[model samples]
Target: MSKKVIHKANTRGHANHGWLDSHHTFSFARYYNPERMNFGLLRVLNDDIVAPGMGFGAHPHDNMEIISIPLSGELAHQDSTGNKKVIKTNDVQIMSAGSGLTHSEFNNSKTDQVNFLQIWVFPKEQDITPRYEQKTFNPADRQNKLQTVVGPEKDAENIWINQDAWFTLGSLKTGFSEDYKLHKTGNGVYAFVLEGEVEIDGEKLSKRDGMGISDTENVSIKASSDAELLLMEIPMR
Candidate 1:
């Protein structure tokens, strides 16, 4: 049997700073909920919208696997590793803050606001060499199929992270369906609804809603409508 945990879109922690509005799916910054600290090794899932001409200043992170995905507009990124680039839609970025690093992300468009997801997962090992990687995914490739965007295995076409995790994205037409198989036995899967509607396992999820399930080999995803979804399989311990 499979167990599930749910996070409703409206129940997430929210913070608006005039220039930036953020929603935390899990406990983040000043938003603390002991029960919502994390889902297995998946620590932070933040939905952020940065206003035009406004962004976050440089900050520090260490021993965390950071992944950034832009949903709209452009996000300008800079880091102490000397990696500076602008990421737009379909672009996924990973930063291994092994030992330590300072980074900043800003809205690249002076007129258009930027909306993105900033995720944090605890690394399997600590104090290794800091690194960064970014890849562009074709939306067509994910049409009706799960596209492997981040995983432990290095891919010529897909991006990989430093942890024992697998991340997939899918865009489905109305009434379409799919099954996502877990890569590791002890890993739990987090299904995040990006847009439209879907049913994961047996739970219906709308935009920004999330569900976590574990102790299973595969999860069923059926699109109730045209949908964009993200699946993350992460270690339980």
Candidate 2:
């Protein structure tokens, strides 16, 4: 049997600070829900929209695998490691805050708001060398299919992370269905709907809804309409 939990879009914690609007899927900052603390090694999932020319100042982090996926507009990134870049939609960025690092992100466009997802995962090991990587993926590659964006492997395609985890994105047409097998045993999959509607193993989810499924080897996904989906597979232990 599989264990599952659903987090409806409206149930997420919301914070509006004029320049930054954020939604938390787990306990973060001022949001405190003991039951919604984490999904295995996946610690944070934040959906954020930043006003043009506004962004987060420098902040420090250590011993964590952080990932950013821009949904729309452009995000300017700067880190203590001397990396500066602009990421737009279809780009995936990962930062391994192994020992320690300070970074900040801002909306690159002065006339447009930037929307992105910020994710944090607990590292497999602590206190190593910090690193940063960013890649732009072709949207057509995920059309009616899943595209691996980040994983634990070193390759020209996917960005590497400090944990035994894989992040995949899917762009599905209405009536499309697919089976997503677990990359490793004992790993769980968290499916987050980015747009449209989807049904995962018979459970329906709308835009921004999240579902954590564990104790299972695979999952069946069907699109009720044209949809964008994000799947994060991480170790449960």
Candidate 3:
């Protein structure tokens, strides 16, 4: 087993748009912080809460793999590729903005807020072809266990990307523990807690806290409370 590397990132970058409140766990465009740039190939992780009837306008992207996980409410997505969809809690969406693509996301409800996590990862190879996909997963599948949501397989239940990385989600009951083995020897896992508390690799992580662990074959997680967590395993270098 390789040595484990651990640290709690200094959370930075926050923008409140009256309708949308967002927090950047890593450096993002227009919210740059060199010290919090990235964790391995996990480039961006944005925690967003969109007020009813509001969301991001149409935007363009290129050469990046994007994943959106909804925590609550509903997200309406449309793209130049002629795709239109609504994503709710337990739903996952991925867009391979290979070469280039244009898209827009909005909250579909007018009376409730929508909270979601938007993540971006660097692709192993760039400029392939633009693609989009979305899937609604059964929350029970992640109850007290990790469920693989994204991977390099076309047959995966969720969206597929162009890299060897994998994304998993888990919801642990209080006092429950689970172990996750890394997907690749040279890759690392970035764990993010969405609710409750968790102990990972001997470190404690509270709600909204994140940690990156690499150079290890596996890591264990013990929940202090009923908790929801996301783990992204990607290349380290």
Compare the candidates by lDDT and give the number of the best one.
Answer: 2
Measured on C-alpha atoms, candidate 1 has an lDDT of 0.94
lDDT per residue, candidate 1, 50-162, as tens digits? 99989999999999999999999999999999999999999999999999999999999999999999999999989979999998999999999889899888764678788
TM-score of each: 0.98, 0.99, 0.94
Ranking by TM-score: 2, 1, 3
Which parts of model 3 are misplaced by more than 4 Å? Answer: 1-10
Query: Which structure is stronger by TM-score: 1 or 3?
Result: 1
TM-score of the candidate numbered 2? Answer: 0.99
Question: How many collisions per candidate?
Answer: 0, 0, 0
In candidate 2, the residue pairs with backbone N, CA or C atoms under 3 Å apart (3 or more residues apart, or in different chains) clash, namely: none
lDDT of each: 0.94, 0.96, 0.87
Q: Which residue pairs in model 3 clash with each other? A: none
Over 100-213, each residue of candidate 3 has an lDDT whose tens digit, in order, gives: 989999999999999999999998789988999888888899898899999998886767988889999998999988789887888889989888899998788888888888
Cand. 2 Cα-lDDT: 0.96
